[model samples]
Target: MAHEPAVIAALDVARPLVVDLGYGARPDTTVEMAGRLRRVAPDLEMVGLEIDPARVVDPRDGVRFAVGGFEMAGLRPRVVRAFNVLRQYDETEVDAAWSRLRAALSPGGVIVEGTCDEIGRRCTWVLLDVAGPVSLTLCWAPEHSERPSDLAERLPKALIHRNVPGEKIHDLLTLADQCWDIAAPLAPYGPRVRWRHAQDLLRERGVDCVVTRRRMSDNVLTVPWEAVAP
Candidate 1:
C-alpha cells in the first residue's frame, strides 16, 4: 500500500474503508495490514471478511471481522486486499468475481487481488480499479526464484492458464528469464543486484516497468495490464 500511489490515494479518502477479503481462519494477516496501512491513513477503517461464518471471529486491534465474499458483505470499501481467494475458483468464473467486487467498491476504489505461496516468497497480483484491471505485479524473494519466470506458478487465476506459447504473458516471462541470464555477470554481487540489472535490461528492451525509488528486499516487476492481456 505504501509503495503504490493509487492505493495510497484511495486510502486518503474522507472515510477510507479497507477490507481484507477471505482473510482465512486467523486474523493475523488482517491485523498486520491494519498496522501497516495506519501509517498512510490513520483514520481508515478495516474489516476482515470470510465466506465461512465459523471463520469470522471477534474484532481485534481495530479490525472488524465478518462473513462476506466477493459481494463485499454489502459494504462499499475504498480498498480491498483479496489474496488467494480466486485461485479456488475456475478461470471462467474470474470475470464474474471481479465484476462483483468492482460493483461493491466506493468511488475511486482499488482492489489488489492475487495468489502467493504458503510463506509468500512468490506472489502475483492484479491491481484493479472501477473500470478494470490496471496492472499486474510479480514479487518474489530473490533467492526463492531461479528466474523471473519461476514465479509463473504464483500467477493469479485470470492469467494462470494463459502462460502458453503466443501469449503476451508468456512472452513477457520468457523475455524476463532471458534478461536474467544475460545479467549473469552481476550474480557475483548477489541476487538482488543481479535482479536489478535484469530489470534494467528489461527496460532497455522497451518493456515499460514501474521504477522503484529505493532498493527493495524482493524482486518486483509491474507492467500495465495491456502488456499481458489475454
Candidate 2:
C-alpha cells in the first residue's frame, strides 16, 4: 500500500477507513496490517471483518472486528485488503463477489485482492478501483520460483482459471520464462538480480511492467490488467 502511488493517493484522504475483509480465524494479520498502514495514515480507521458472527472479536490495537462478507459489513472503506477470501468460492462467483466489494467501497477507493501460498513464498493480486481492475501483480521469493510463471498457481481467482494456452496470462508467463532462461548468465549475481534482469528483458520485448528502482524483498512484476486479461 505504501509503495503504490494509486493506493497512497487513496489513503491520503480525510478520515480514511481501511478494511481487512475476511481476516480469517485470527486477528493477527489484521493487527499487523493496521500497524503498517498507520505509518502511511495514522488517523485511518481499520476494521477486520469475518462472515462468521461467532468469529468476531472485540476491538483491539485500533482495529474493530465485525461480521461481514463481500458486503463489507455495510461500511464503505477507502481501501480493502481481501487476501485469500475468494479462493474457497467457485470461479463463476468471482465477478459477483467483486461487484459486491466494489459497491462497498468509498469514492476513489481501491481494493487489493489476491492469494498467497501457505508459506507466502508465492503470491498474486489485482489492484482495482471504482473504474475496475487496473493491474495484476505477481510476487514471489526468487529462490522459491524456478520461473516467474511458477507463481501462476497463486493468481487471483479472476485469472487463475485463465492461465491456460492462448490466454494473455499464459503468453506473459511464457515470455517471462523465456526471458529468465535468456538471463541465465546473471545467476551468479543471485536470483533477485537475475529476476530483475528478466523483467528488464520483458520490458525490452514490449511488455509494460511497473519496474521499480527500489530493491524489494520479493521479485515483483506488475502489468496493466489488460496485459493479462482473459
Candidate 3:
C-alpha cells in the first residue's frame, strides 16, 4: 500500500483503486490493505475479486467484493496485487495471464503478482506495467534465512523451476550464497549490514540489480529481469 502514491501519481488519478485478486474466501486481507492504503491515499478504494462468486465476503470497511478473474470486473485499477494466485497454473500460462490482467489496468497501472511463504517470511514478486514485467523483487524476513539464495524455495512460479542448474536463476542464487559467505564478517554487526554487503558483492560481480538503500533495510532486493530470466 505504501506504493499507492507513486502508482496514483503516475496514472494521474485522483482516487486510485487497488484490486486484490483471488483473495480466497476471506476478505480480511483486502480490508486490511484498504485501511493501510487510506493512510497514504485518503481516497484510495479497494476491491476484492474472486472467480467463485460464493467465496466473496460481505463488503465492509470500504472494501467491496466482486466476482471476477483475469478479466478484472470491468474496473481499471491502479495496482492489482495478485499474491499467490498463479501457483497452481502451468508456467506456460503465465504470459497470457499477465496479458489479461494488463489489459484491465488504467494507463500507468501495474500488476504486482507473486508467491509468498506462509507468514510472508520469504517471497518473490514481479512488478509489471502494461508493457511487461519490469522487475523482480525478492523479500525475506532478516532472521528467517542465512543466505539470500535460501529464497529460491519461494520464487514466484514463473521462475521457481528455473532455479535448477544451467539456468540464470540458478547462477544468480549461487552467486548470492557465495557472496553471503564472503560477507559473513558483517553478520556480527547485524543481518542488515551483512545483507547490504552481500548486495554490494553482487554489484561488484556485475549482477544487474536495482539498489534501493531504504528498501534494503526491509530485507528486500529488486533485480532486473534480464539478470535472472530463464
Question: Using TM-score as the measure, which candidate wins?
Answer: 1
lDDT string, candidate 1, 1-230, tens digits? 45778899899777599999998878898999999999999999999999999999998999999999999999999999999999889999999999999999999999999998987899899999999999999999988788989988899999999999999999999999999999999999998888888889999998998867588898899999999999
Residue 40 local lDDT, model 1: 91
The lDDT ranking, best first, is: 1, 2, 3
Sorting all predicted structures by TM-score, with the top scorer first, yields 1, 2, 3
How far off is model 1, as Cα RMSD?
A: 1.0
**Model 3 lDDT tens row, 1-230:** 25523454643568887899998768777788777667767788789999998998777988999998999999899888898899999999999999999999988898889988867788889888899887888888888887788888888888998998999889988988898889998888998888888889999999877666664445777787877777
Q: Comparing candidate 2 with candidate 3, which one achieves the higher lDDT?
A: 2
Candidate 2 local Cα displacement, residue 80, angstroms? 0.6
Model 1 ranges off by over 4 Å: none
Model 2 steric clash total: 0
Please report, as a residue range, the 10-residue window in candidate 1 with the lowest summed lDDT. 209-218
The 0-to-1 C-alpha lDDT of every candidate, in the order given, reads 0.92, 0.90, 0.83
